[model samples]
Target: MSEDFKKKFDDVLNKIKRELDSIAKRIDEYLEKGEIYRAYRIWRDAVLDSLKMLRNALNTLGEEFKDIKFSEDDLNNIAKYTREGIREIVDKLEEIGNRIRELRGRGYLWIWFDLKPIKDLFQEVAEEVNVTMDGVLSHVEKFISSLEKAFEDTGRRASQVVSVRIKEKDLELIDRLVEVGIFRSRSEAVAFFTRRGIESSKDWIEKALEHAKKIKELQEAIRREIGGEEGEEDKENQGKP
Candidate 1:
């Protein structure tokens, strides 16, 4: 009976490992093709399924091994690490989603852009998650280390919300820009225009300053020329007197 239970436990662990490998491969392939959204969908679903399977397997293992010398505390710690690891991956996915929204708002459809860097980032995260999951099934200490390594690879960034009110005409213009493929969405259009406007304002200010400087130099030159002419006339008048 103990042998049978141990065989089943090993089988479950092997199955989890296989599934994790499959999922990681799929994610890598998709990301390599620059299909970020598709990769994200796969990642989200695979993580959820893997978590469910992992939890079930852990529960079954604990029940079967209760009579054995296995420490319940160790099992509980494993479960905790698994949950926390999944949470961390999910949080990273959410951050990516938010960034997508932000890009769309700025009139950037990254779909048409070179996304190798972004894809690489996703691949890195997916690989990390897979490695961490494997460690969770094998050793708790390694699992923690893997998770921390993944987090360090992907540093954290702060974000904030901004509100703006646009006129109907401006909104229409944004739509037209999107229609013309200048942007992927209204948000993207708005973001693009806002950035362009800022750049244009800076340029205008620079040009204005240059013109003002030229005007000042011209005025000084005119004053000097006029003063020289007046001095010459006064000399002529003095000589005649």
Candidate 2:
């Protein structure tokens, strides 16, 4: 019976080692490839495997792991990290969203002038658009300032409530976006737009492209007019000479 138990224990240990090695390899590959989405998936699987291993080890020790309680400090620390990560992600997403909104407004402003009668365009719309743009840019400026202040405020107990809790659904939404190449990762998507003040809120890039073509046409027309005038001057000079 003693020999049999020893053999079983050795098998379980080997199985656990294999699981850990696989998890570690996955992590290394994800990190090397800079694949944040894959990294998160691997990390989650590793956590699940670790929990299972812990349970099995506890079982081997003749204790029911599920019945074991966590200390208050452990729970609190977990909550703190979880809350901080969620809040950071949400803040980044919102920053990207605000940028997209601003770009959409610019797109609309450009379109509103497209051969439309001056009388048909609402004066209120024009005024509101300007006001909204100012407001958003101002917010962006303030956010840059407050962002530093936020780091300072983090350790204050009063600011703990400011943390956002990211749920599994939030991560799922980001993962789907990542798969489509709209984002390399949730962090990249958030970082790219937040710094540039753009977002996936609307097809602003297409609109901007259209707007750019129109401006180019206008510039070419102006250049042709100037060239024509120069030609006319040359002709007059030739006749006078």
Candidate 3:
């Protein structure tokens, strides 16, 4: 990941974490004062905002980790679990909406807005979201760690993660390789074939890309010179182990 991208990702993730905490506090304050009606709009607005944030977070994860394929020990069904979590949260939010509307429809009865049920609902949703968000956050943080680790130690034999889309036939071919025990996993099979394919094109690539290689070398030299001029910081001070 690029430095600019890492900064933006951190900002987005922090905003999401802050938003959820703030939403709960705001709603609780209104509910505590026996202002169920006042909490209604806050609840509705929070739902919309939360949904937007959830989607943005998911999209960011997908984009940032698009190349980082997960093994069974890594990110498992990120899109699926995150989407399902979003759906459940939305459904809970909808239930809260319906309850608020029902109370509002009564419109005039002092006793109609019991507030207890909705309060319970707020608690339920909080618990649900906390559990779901924990999973999402852990996976993202893990991805960031993995990305940084790989980038920093190019020569280290780290367990790299790569994710990508494949056609039906392509997926079947990968699976077939795994089934035959030629590879331990779909990731392994994909990596093997991909490396092999690149090697097969080495001759043509070298012949046709001579100018490009020189340009790339120039860019690398410039980057190296800039690093030297700046006196690179210690990894330990930068939060490395």
Candidate 4:
């Protein structure tokens, strides 16, 4: 990935980390207040939201990585690992939810004073989630590092290099485009847009010629009508004179 894209991806991961930290903090606050239900709700929502954000970040990173040509086996391994991680988190979340529901069904009111077993279960599950999240985060960082190294190695292997001068504003635009996954690099963006413009220019020319032809035909029809009317009028006048 380009520097701009890497920065954006890092921003996304940082936001997710902050959000997860906030959620964990809120869970602790609720638990301290003896509001077990509130804590549980917060935990559930946090897990769901975190998973969603992580998945989105992974997908975005995957798109960015596609720009770098990598081995199919490496790509497949990454995808498989990601899917397994998500699945494990989802399963754990579901298990926690089901345990909570079972306790609720058994007349457990979640009062802090007498709910030792439930509290223990909650803590256990929460710890597991924390561990899982940490693992996932670590794996993601490693994955990114590996990709970066691969990109560097690929660059080193390339035998040809081309340099071009670009205006500052155009460079900014290219960076934005790269950040948005429009192109892998400025060179790619330039090549793709140039090719598209060349291909579309031919189409545009053809359409313009078609329109010109239609206009010519219409003008000829109008001229014929006007000339025929004038000739008729002239003949009538000549006969009268």
Q: Candidate 1: global Cα-lDDT?
A: 0.48
lDDT of 1 by residue, 28-66 (tens): 675454344455456545544654564666556555555
RMSD per candidate (Å) reads 19.4, 26.9, 26.4, 25.4
**Worst 10-residue lDDT window, candidate 2:** 105-114
lDDT of 2 by residue, 63-111 (tens): 3222334343433332233233323433433332233224321221110
Summarize candidate 4's per-residue lDDT along 110-212 as a digit string, tens digits.
Answer: 2111223322322343344233333434455454344334433433332112112334454465455555444555446545544554344446544655666
- TM-score for all models, in order of appearance: 0.31, 0.32, 0.30, 0.31
Give the winner by lDDT: 2 or 3: 3
Q: What is the Å distance of residue 158 in model 3 from its true position?
A: 54
Q: How close to the true structure is residue 30 of candidate 1, measured as C-alpha lDDT?
A: 57
Candidate 3 deviant stretches above 4 angstroms? 1-25, 28-37, 70-76, 104-241
Q: How many angstroms is residue 145 displaced in model 2 relative to the true structure, after the best TM-score fit?
A: 43
